[model samples]
Target: MAGQIPMTRNGVERLKEELHQLKSQDRPNIIQAIAEARAQGDLSENAEYESAKERQGFIEGRIAEIEAKLSNVQIIDPSVLNADGKCVFGATIELEDLDEEKSFTYQIVGEDEADIKANKISISSPLARALIGKEDGDVVEVETPGGQKTYEITNVSYI
Candidate 1:
């Protein structure tokens, strides 16, 4: 399906962790807060009760969201992937900026696992798209908002 989301093993684990936190921690805490607020309030004029209810609604919504994602997640472990050294999903790649002459590392991952600050880029990103199917030592030119930039693939690893 067009909406099907692919996730790495780590990404799925992270989602499960968040769901666990929301269920075991946030859910009970909010329910207790609501009970406390209800004991001190008249039905229509209780701001504490209203706020607690709103928070409960948000928590329940997120729990449902996480459950849905887990239900449909396809976990792929990058460490076991071997594409004969060609770049693909779950590849850790090292690149040298042709213009800047600076080296950096990035791992191509699913949308949920993509964190620019952590140097994990989404597979759908322009740079990732350009790098896909490319082998080590290949030069790729990616179009960005700043314009086209060239990068040389220095290394590619599955791990």
Candidate 2:
């Protein structure tokens, strides 16, 4: 539960693409900048050299972090899931607020792929924690920043 990260196929590819870009493009560019800065002499007084070194450090850190996450990933295809209509990771769920008369839809995903604007919520989020293992037509309570609220699940889909 703690070590392995659950990620969709698309999410895995996106992270991999970011790692590749940081390594193949950003890394080379920063190295080139550092070389050029070294040619200008005095590194202690060189802003360009300092900036490039900082950027290189950031890129290298990100590369390692992404690689570690990728290595511990448990890739799951939502389309292939069979949860018997119960809400689970990778499940797209629709909920209707019983109080405010509003509807919300979200797909439960890994932390790396969570984007509220895109309707993707992290599995560890408060609402997601409440929704997991729930079924359609089930009423659930969640503690939001706006205080406690109730929602009735309208639908749950793996895709």
Candidate 3:
């Protein structure tokens, strides 16, 4: 579909797992809580019932959101992508900080899968945007919150 969100295979799997858990476990638990709260009587001043209803609304909203995203998701597998050694979505990149000489590795992924702790960066991020379409040995400058930073692309691999 047009305007579908691009996501890695692993990202899609994680989303599916979360949706499943929410529907199977959380939804049922919330329903039980609401039923128990309803049994306490006095609906207008029932704090437990009100809280359960609010939680139910949040869970339902999240379920709809995840379902919509999954329906419009475009799964991209990194291992099967070929970009001619240039940086692109699903490409794992190795870079060296021009100023600090620090080496780092990151995989350009969808927004949902961006985790700094895991070295996964969103494709729309400043650094990822600068690195995109760049080849090995190329230097790119990125405008960051801490001012401009430069990095040299040491390697790019689809893994």
Candidate 4:
């Protein structure tokens, strides 16, 4: 497990789904597009063919990247974790900003699963790093691009 990347079960499933789509749908579509473009005209001045080839390269690169990540994934089920009251990987945490009096929730996830829109933070992020091993009611201070911010851990849930 030394080289394995820790990710939630849900994260792994999402990645697998994306990989399936890329391989089964996107790859074939790009191949078809390239073939159609090739049939249209001369290879020397074919804009469509050039664009399709570039897109095909991108799609293949992404497929390789996803496959590599999936192969090295270490899926962790948050529901089955027993980390006591400490914040750990895959733990969903509710935090209250001490200065702004605002509440925020975030799940610690692998780099590939981190999405700010979904309130998921990468485990290696500054805020997650500060929160890890901390318990509810613990105050965490993190330095960000804006400035230093303080948050009090209000709740920590495995799921």
Candidate 5:
């Protein structure tokens, strides 16, 4: 088994929902499809059977993956965190681009919950790594793919 998978409360709930859907709905439906396809005679030339089998493999893989992740999950709730104004796991940070002077907000979250469009950054990301342990008004430089980017921490909040 790998190390613990860090996840937020919402991330765990989302994964649990997906696991439920796969086991209760997708798995059963795929089994039924395979059985129905098998009833149609020859197995070698049955495209439906092949497709169903492939889908079954995918579903089973997903189920196992979700199960493993859940088994090793470390859930964190941002609303209850107390970081004393420092950027840490589950901290929502407000930043100002030093180059462009534009303001942005991002929440540091687990990899599974990170969504750039939603302003949830992964803890392992360059910007998040730079922001970690930094207090409000601290300046941080991140090595982005485009180039080096600088930002000032305008605010830090747990929730």
Candidate 6:
């Protein structure tokens, strides 16, 4: 089945930049390298030619992959999201752990843009799944690998 690939505006921009670089810089560089290598010798025994050809293949493959990703991207802007204090895609949510009374914040984002160090969780993650549709003061239960945990929604905002 075809799956959705949600991406933040920044993520989409990054992908576009990468695609542009591959097409404009990397592609031309590899073509030149291949041409130079081919000029040096026989078709069958030229190691440099073989290496350059391999590099060209890899670069082309990456270019195709990036193109496909860009084509399928669904861009989302956090600043425009309006869930009315309810957790949703592109929402930055504050939570208080029921057991520890400690607070944490996480932004629900797409898988491609999820970064644990940045406190951004994918929309399809277990924690995000539990938090979705919940408003401030709502309590959500999440089933984690460690155990069942409960968190109280403290705040939800876009951006």
User: What's the C-alpha lDDT at position 23 in model 5?
Assistant: 89
Per residue, candidate 2 scores C-alpha lDDT tens digits across 1-159 of 258999988799999999999989999999999999999999999999999999999999999999999999999887787899999999999999999999999999999999999999999999999999999999999999999999999999988
Model 3 scores worst on lDDT over the 10 consecutive residues at 1-10
User: CA lDDT of 71 in candidate 5?
Assistant: 99
Regions more than 4 Å wrong, model 5:
none
Rank list by TM-score: 4, 2, 3, 5, 1, 6
> Poorest 10 consecutive residues of model 6 by lDDT?
1-10
Q: How many clashes in candidate 2?
A: 0
Q: Please, what are the lDDT tens digits per residue for candidate 6 over residues 6-125? A: 888877887788889988998899899889988887969988889889988998898888777777888877678766778878888999999888999999988877898999999999
lDDT of model number 5: 0.93
Candidate 1 ranges beyond 4 A from true positions: 1-3
TM-score of each: 0.92, 0.96, 0.95, 0.96, 0.94, 0.78
Of candidate 2, the 10-residue stretch with the lowest lDDT total is 1-10
Clashes of each: 0, 0, 0, 0, 0, 0
- All candidates: CA RMSD in angstroms? 1.6, 1.4, 1.3, 1.4, 1.3, 2.8
Best by TM-score: 4
**All candidates' lDDT scores?**
0.92, 0.94, 0.93, 0.94, 0.93, 0.87
TM-score of 1: 0.92
lDDT of 3: 0.93
| lDDT tens per residue, model 1, 1-159 | 336678888888899999999999999999999999989969699999999999999999999988988888787776787689999898999999998899999999998899999999999999999999999999999999998899999999987
Looking at model 1, which ten-residue stretch has the lowest summed lDDT?
1-10
Write candidate 5's Cα lDDT for 12-127 as tens digits. 99999999999899999999999999999999999999999999999999999999999999988767877788999888999999998899999999998899999999999999
Q: Write the per-residue lDDT of candidate 4 for residues 79-140, one digit (tens) a residue.
A: 78789989999999999999899999999999989999999999999999999999999999
Deviating ranges (above 4 Å) for candidate 2: none
Which candidate wins on lDDT?
2
Model 6 scores a TM of: 0.78
108, model 3: CA deviation in Å? 0.7
